[model samples]
Target chain A: MNASLFDILTIWLQRPNFIAFIILFLWGLYIMIAHHNLIKKLIGMYLVQTSVIFFFITVSAKAGATVPILLNGESVDPALYANPLPHVLMLTAIVVGVATLGVSLALVVAIYRQYGSLDEEVILKQLGE
Target chain B: MRHHLPVFVFLLPFGMAICMPLISLVRPKWCRGLTMLALAAMTGLSVMLYSHVIAQGPIRYALSGWMPPLGIEWIVDGLSGLLLPLLGSLALMGVWYAGPLVTEGKGSIHFHLLTLLLVSGLSGMVMAGDLFNIFVFLEVSALSSYALVGSAGGRALVSAFRYLILGTLGASLYLLGVGYFYAVTGTLNMTDLADRLPDLLASKAVMAGFIFMLIGLGIKMALVPLHGWLPDAYVDAPDSVSPLLAPLVTKVALYAVVRVMYWVVGGEEVGETLPILTLSSWLGAVAALVGAFLALSQQELKRMFAYAGISHVGIIVMGVCLGNPTGFAGGIFYLLTDAVMQAALFYIAGTAFYSLGIRTLADLGRLRGQMPWVIGVLIVIAISMIGIPPSGGFFGKWYIILGALEAGNYIVVGGVVGATLLTLGYFVTIFERIFVDSVSSGPAVLAESPLSMRATMGMLAAASLVLGLMSDPMIRLILDHAFPG
Candidate 1:
């Protein structure tokens, strides 16, 4: 039991990628909530999405693994190949992220044209007036 | 040919939506006709599929001829069979009501296109049997709705932006949960996940996954504190946009919650192992009270109705969290009834805005004399919203109260009753304005609504009455087959 506990501790410490991913996610969330500018919010949204992508890629990684692609004449061993599903899924997620960014930017442009400000507080005040 | 009904129901709308831009360039008048035709066909298909499912059982179709655990699948069980027909009919009504209003402008084509896409996305969400596929369809629906809300321009732009930000956050959280599940189990199929989840119930990652998913979908369903975007999006949207969105979007999100909790994760874990259901029940009770109280303060008609919608959503959530078959069926019945009632109310509000320029209680005082038909329908819908006898809303509340009593949950029963009285309180204000107050002396600037709009509103109002009278059969049908026994 003690050995297993130590093993868990070692694995947790070695997984710095996961820690970085969480930090990036929280940082993005903070910007999204705290920033007054709409553009900054959109940028923060992009950062949040990027962190998710990074986490997925990190999850797909295996120690002592090679590329997922197969060599034509080589004998195949499944344990040596990294999982490919997360990469494919993240590709779709990236496409969805781009589409969302496009829509959000268009909306910001329209809001800027109408209220003449990108700050949410200014826009709300103008709308009230 | 009959086996492909699930695919065709969504595919038909998607195909028509994609073809709309070209059709608009050639003949714009045909755009409305085509959209109506597509929704009507989808309605017919859903009815046929529901009948088939009742006769046989759940139908699962594997995409590209690959079986489950390998390829994407679409399933039409009791839940989807019931919801698909409701969604199709309501969407058809939304389009029919918007026909005359959208036709008067240049952007009518785009409106029809976005509306069709929204319908397709909703249909896809209901029928999808895979978790990842649900996310894809969710994005499809969310993206289209954000654009549809902003299609009116002006103040709608800012509201739509807020919706976009929050909606994307919700979607991101959901995806992160899905990622966690994949990391642990490496499967996305709902049935497969259900099979694997029993053994993994003790894992922290699995627990975190369920928590993340519930919170994400909670925001989408507008459960109280996370409902900041709904009133603004509904109020500032175009007159035609609110009716389509107000009834369907949040309900679909709730459907997703049902699918995830009962199907993917299994209710035993959610009820016994985790405190999710108990927590949801408390939150739902609080939301029911808070939403109704907030509704009491709104002066505008649509904003008031929007708050009332939040209250109804809370009631349905509370019912589902009871973790019993009776409670689950009550939740489904309330969902059906609320969709009909809320859509009819929004349609009436839209009609009032279009025909009489009515926005507040004062504007409604003189409306009785000019537009008796619209005002009459509004009264029936308002009564239903207050859960009066002989209306669909009463039956929904009745079942929920019975379920809560059976579960020995007295606080929830009290919450339901208190919410009902508060609902009556707010709706009575509208009643007094329409029925008792004297007409103002100002000249009438608008005429009565077109025949199509009135006819659709009348049908929806009648549906509420009919559904109330037929509540027993509806409950039986939903209870017998919805969740795995």
Candidate 2:
């Protein structure tokens, strides 16, 4: 039983990409929830987005697989090549991510201009809301 | 033209959204007519497409003539057929009415641009046949709304930021869910997912995908506890934005919910393999009760409508999640009426505020003369809100209650009746204050809203009555194609 548990743990830990994603996502969520600074929260959002993008890329990666480019005069074994669809989709997601980042930063600038601070607690207290 | 209807429905607006700013740069005055013409053209095309889809089966358009599983697909079926027309017209009417009120000078360009983008995004969302495509459109619509929500400046900027954060999180969760689905099946198309999903019901990935999707959509639907961003998003948006979004945004999200839950997940599988559907019904019931009570306690007019929208969302969720055909039929039809009713009420609020600075129940109640036209439309709204006969709202809740009865969910039935009674209570007070009370604090001779605002309000109020008359056919059409073998 002890040997089996260790094996299972090793299997889960083998995927370095998944592990990295979890850490990044959790850290981002923590900042979003725990940080009172608005800019910090924005950073958290970016981290979360990056983690998701990382996850998409990870799902498309394969062991011993070459890029999805078709070589001349070679019979195709689909499994021998990394999947290209998720990569294409992620490029779209990346554009969306950039757009949201731009929009949010614009919003942050607007908030700072009006309230003169980037702290949530301070702004709310100022509003007496 | 008919062959390309599915693509043209959204492409027209998206192309026009791009052009609006350019046109404003040169002939600024022409932007108004272009905006109206674009929306009108989209609405007309949607109606024509709906009829075509009804006669012929689903219309499927592949990008660049590439077939599905390789190229993206856009489909117009019975479900989207019904939605496109309703969403298009409501948007057209909303922007039309907003022109006189909120679209003033330099800012008008951005306003029209964002509104058209919203239209384009919603149209794409309605027609998108792939899960990832839906996500793309979802972000498109969401980004535009985030911009619109803050366009009013001042306090609205804060609400827009909060909405952006919450909305982005929800959408990302949905995208992750799509990744999970794609990882397992290697396909993003809805019909392909449906075919692949049943065999993998026991897979953990499938379970994760479904749960993630439900939670994401729940946030978008603003189902009770997840509704933190909703009230402020609606209440703090520019006056014109509120009228367009307040009535329409959540309903489009509901369209997404229905699409994913039934079209992608399949029917009996949802009940047998999942308890989340049941959870949705209970949460919906609780949200209905809580939201109604909250609306009852509000003094501000728009906030009250915002909270009430949450309540109706709860009812609609309960309706569609019943896992019965009757429930879907009822819940789906009810949302149509609810969307219309919501638009009518917000138009009234907009008209009142722009005309007489009316913001509270008492303020609206104390008005004496001059809104003779408004009084007639107000009666229609009050009738629909109270669930009386010959109004669309009445039939929607009736079917919901009847559906709840069929499902043996006594709690949901009570939620429907209880919220209705509560709404009746407040609406009556407003009426009594208006018609019964002798005191009059409104201006001695108050001026009515512009002709355009009044005309739009009248048009929407009249639709609720017509929708009630039309509910039977609508229900039948939904049943025929929405759940096909």
Least lDDT summed over 10 consecutive residues: which range in candidate 2 chain B?
B439-448
Query: Model 2, DockQ value?
Result: 0.79
Q: Model 1, which residues run further than 4 Å from truth?
A: A1-12, A73-75, B442-446
lDDT score for residue A36 of model 2: 88
Steric clash pairs (candidate 1): none
In CAPRI terms, model 1 is classed as: medium
In model 1, what is the error at residue B368, expressed in angstroms? 2.2
Candidate by candidate, in order, the iRMS in Å equals 0.6, 0.7
TM-score of 2: 0.96
Top candidate (DockQ): 2
Count of clashes in candidate 1: 0
Q: After superposing candidate 2, which stretches have Cα over 4 Å from the reference?
A: A1-8, B432-443
